[model samples]
Target: MKAVRLEEIEQLFLREVERPVPGPDDLLVRVEASGICGTDRHLLHGEFPSTPPVTLGHEFSGIVEAVGSAVLGFRPGMRVTGDPNIVCGHCVHCHAGRINLCQNLRAIGIHRDGALADYVIVPQKQAHELPLSLKPDYGAFCEPLACCLHGIDVAGIKAGSSVVVLGGGVIGLLTVQLARLAGATRVVLVTRQASKRRLAEEIGATASFDPTAGDAAAGIAGPDGLLPGGADVVIECAGVAETMEEMPRLARPGGTLVVLGVMAKGEKIQIEPFDILFRELRILGSFINPFVHRRAADLIISGAIKVEPLITRRVSLEEVPEVIRNPARPGEVKVLFMPSA
Candidate 1:
């Protein structure tokens, strides 16, 4: 099997590796497509906490090559995606239906050998069946889409509301689509990338803004300009301290600000005291997918969300290292690796 290994901080290589065997409760998947995420970059840089020497890939979809003895409801040749956040059922969070915050969680790619190879093992409970209507590349997107769904769940978005999503990356673009589905009347996407901004608009954002333009604050303002609180809900998806700090400033009074991106450890953000006190804003942070993978699959199968346009590029497993080195090489949006390609 060929796998992309994270040999050390800021380094990755595609090399020959032994294939893994599935436990009785696990399913062995022949990975077809795997999405490259910011987390992969985080793993390469050793930024986010994780185990070292791990085969890195979590956003993936594949055909079941084999199943453990105990596995049921699925057989070999079944197409599946899965919840990568494996948690101990005994944990308080797990028992409380908050598995995403489980005390003893071990992610496949982040803590073990994931699907960045010809084959990878996933718990049967984590594996989700895919519909024939979906292409494999789109199936790989279920994980990220699940994470975004979890964010919108926590956000409690209301109908006729306005939304502003920071950053025009995959997460931001997904957020825009989810916001529209949540019944938000108008959604604005803000990013530094021109290509991504264009993608954002195509994905249902009412408007897209380049923060680099003069006074982005003004451009983001709502109609009539009476309040800088133009956005009813501000989703911070940039993963930058500056964007995180600006969340409160971009929301309407009594608005909700959800931080959906992962910032580096020990980073700090400055917020004005008045924004929290006078505005009485509701600020929240969104974490991982939280057992929402199946819901995401349903969303995809039912055609409730469209993710085909989010895939900007596809390459073979051998190109994984190079793709990570330069994510901005040309196109923007999610990049999927076809391991068997």
Candidate 2:
């Protein structure tokens, strides 16, 4: 089997490795499609904490090539999306139903061999069934959509609400659609990329903004700006220092700010605590998909969330290392690796 392995920090290569055999409670999925995430780049550059000498693809879905004896309700030939995050059920957070906060968290691609290969093992608990009829490339989006779903869940978007999405990447674009589905009447996407800005509006954003053109905070929240008095909810999905620093200012007094972006570890950004205190704003840090993977799968399967537009390109596993080594191409949203290609 060929697997894209991160031998160590700043080292990544597609190496031939022995195929993995599934454990009693696991499923051996033949990798079909896996999305290259920003976290993959983070892992490569040692910006994020990840156990090296492991395969590096977390957002993936594939066909079940084989199943463990203990696996139930699933069989060979089933199409499924894997929830890469594994939690210890006995952890305090897990007991409290906060599994994403589990103290002993081990994630596929980050800590274990993942779907960036010919085969990857998925615990039965982490596999979600997808219709065989679903597009193979679309299945790869389930993981990212799941993470976005968690962000939407915590944002508390309501009917007639207004939302400002910072960044026009896949996460931000997905968040825009979810916000609209959650009943936000007005959704504004903030990004400098003209192409992504155009795509955002076409998808669901009521409007879009170019931060490089003028003052983003004032342009979105100024008395004469789009939202006028700021948005009901502001989500920072750019995962950049500039967006992180400007996130709070885009929200109205007493509104919410959800940090759904994955910034590198040890990254710092200046923020004003006084504004949050004075406005009594609600600020939340949404981690990985906790209990929303199923909903994300359903949304994707049902075509409730449009993912086809978010896919920028599809590459082979051989091209993955180079793709991850460089920055995402201009206006690129999501790139998937077709293992069988």
Candidate 3:
């Protein structure tokens, strides 16, 4: 089996390795499609903490080639998406139902061998079933959708609410659709990319704007701006410092702001604590999918969230290392690695 291995920080390659056998509580899945995430680049550049000498794909799904004897409700030939994050059930966070904050978090792609190869191991607890009738590539999006679902859950969007999604990448685009589904009457997407801006509106954004053209904050929040007094909820999905600084500004006084994007470790951003204090704003940090994987899968299977538009390209395992190393191409939303391609 050939796997895309992160031998160490700044070192990645496609190497031939022995196939893995499943544990008693695990399933051996043949890699079908895996989405290349920003975190993959972070792991490559050592921006995100990860155990090296492991496969580097977390947003992945595939057909079950074999199942462990202890596994139930699943069998070979089934399609499943893996929730890569594995939390210790005994941890304080887990006991409190905050498993995403588990102290002993060991993600499959980050901490163990993952689905960037011919075969990867998934514990029964992390496996979510998908319909076999669904598109093969669509399954790869379940993991990302799960993460976005958590952000939406934390944002607490309501009917007739307004939302501003910063950045037009996969996360932002998905967030836009979810916001609308969550009953936000007005959804505005801010991004410099003209293509992505157009796509955002095409999907669900009531409007889209180019942040580079003028003062993004004022343009959106000014009296004559789109939202006028500002949106009811502002989500920072860009993970950049500028957007981080602008998140609070885009939300109306006493409104909510959710930071769902992944910023590199040690990255710093300047923020005004006075504004938050004066306005009584609510700020939240949403982590990975905690208990939303199943809902994400159901959404994907039911076509409640559109993912076909988000997939930008598909490459084989041999091409994954290069794709992960370079920055995303302009207008590129998501790229999937098909080990069998």
Candidate 4:
């Protein structure tokens, strides 16, 4: 089997490896589609914690080629999406139903061999069934969409609420759609990319802003701006220093600010604590998908959250190492690797 291995920090390659076998409660999925994520780049640079000498794809879906003897309610022909984050059920957080914050956490792609190869093993608990009639590429989006759903849950969006999404990447775009579905009437997407801004508007954003054109704060929240008094909720999805610094300023007094982005470890950003104190703002940091994988799968399967537009490119596994070695291409939203291609 061919897998994209992160041999070590700053060392990645497409290597031939032995195929994996399923455990008693695991499913051996033949990799169909896997999406390249920003975290993959972060892992490559050692900016994010990951176990090296492992396959590097977490957002993926595939056909079940084989199933363990202990598995039930699933067969070898089922199409499924794998939840990469596996938690220790005995952890304090898990006992409290906060599995994402499990004290002992091991994630596929990050901590174990993942779906970047010809075959990857998924425990029965983490695999969600998808209709065989669904598009293979779309299934790859379930993991990321699940994470975005968690962010939306944390943001607590309501009917007629206003939202400002900072970033036009896949996460940001997905957030925009979820905000609208949550009944937010005013959704503004802020990004420097003109193409992404246009796409955001077309998808669900009531309006879009380019930070490079003028003062983003004033343009979005200033007098006569889109949201004259700031948005009811501001979600930072860029995972960059500039957006992280500007997140609080985009929220109205007493409104909420949710950080859905993943900044590199040890990175520093300047934020005003006094401003948060004065506004009495609600701030939150949303981690990976905790309990929202099923909902994300349902949304995608129902065609409610449009993902076809978010897919920018589809490449073979051979092209994945280079894609992760560098930054995303201009205006690229989501790129998937077709393992069988």
Off by over 4 Å in 4: none
lDDT of 3 by residue, 1-341 (tens): 99999999999999999999998999999888999999999999998999999998899889999888899998999999999999999988899999999999999999999988888999999999888899889999999999999999999999999999999999999999999999999999999999999899889999998988898778888898999988899999988888998898888998999999989999999888999999989999999999999999999999999999898999988898999989999999999998556
Tens digits of lDDT, candidate 4, 1-341: 89999999999999999999899999999989999999999999999998888899999999999999999988989999999999999988999999999999999999999887888999999999999999999999999999999999998999999999999999999999999999999999999999999999999999999999988889999998999989999999999999999988888999999999999999999988999999999989999999999999999999999999999989898999999998999999999999655
Q: Candidate 2, residues 223-267: lDDT per residue as tens digits?
A: 999999899999999999999989888889999999999899998
lDDT, candidate 3, equals 0.92
Off by over 4 Å in 1: 222-228
* C-alpha RMSD values across all candidates: 1.7, 0.8, 0.8, 0.7
Which candidate, 1 or 4, would have the higher lDDT against the true structure? 4
- lDDT against the true structure, per candidate, is 0.85, 0.94, 0.92, 0.94
lDDT of 3 at 34: 92
- Candidate 1's displacement at residue 270, Å, is 1.1
- Backbone clash tally for model 1? 0
Worst 10 residues of 3 by lDDT: 332-341
Q: What lDDT does model 4 reach?
A: 0.94
Considering only N, C-alpha and C atoms within 3 Å, which residue pairs clash in candidate 4? none
Tens digit of per-residue lDDT, candidate 1, span 1-341: 89998877887999898888889998999998999898898788778988878889999999999989999998998999978888888988888988888899999889988888889898998889996567888888899899899989888888998888998888998899999999988898888888888888887998888778755566676453323447888999879988888788778788889999999877888888786989899989899998688988888888778788887878898888888776455447788899545
Deviation of model 4 at 104, angstroms: 0.7
Q: How displaced is residue 147 in candidate 1, in Å?
A: 0.6
Runs in model 3 deviating more than 4 A are none
Return the TM-score for candidate 2, rounded to 2 decimals.
Answer: 0.99
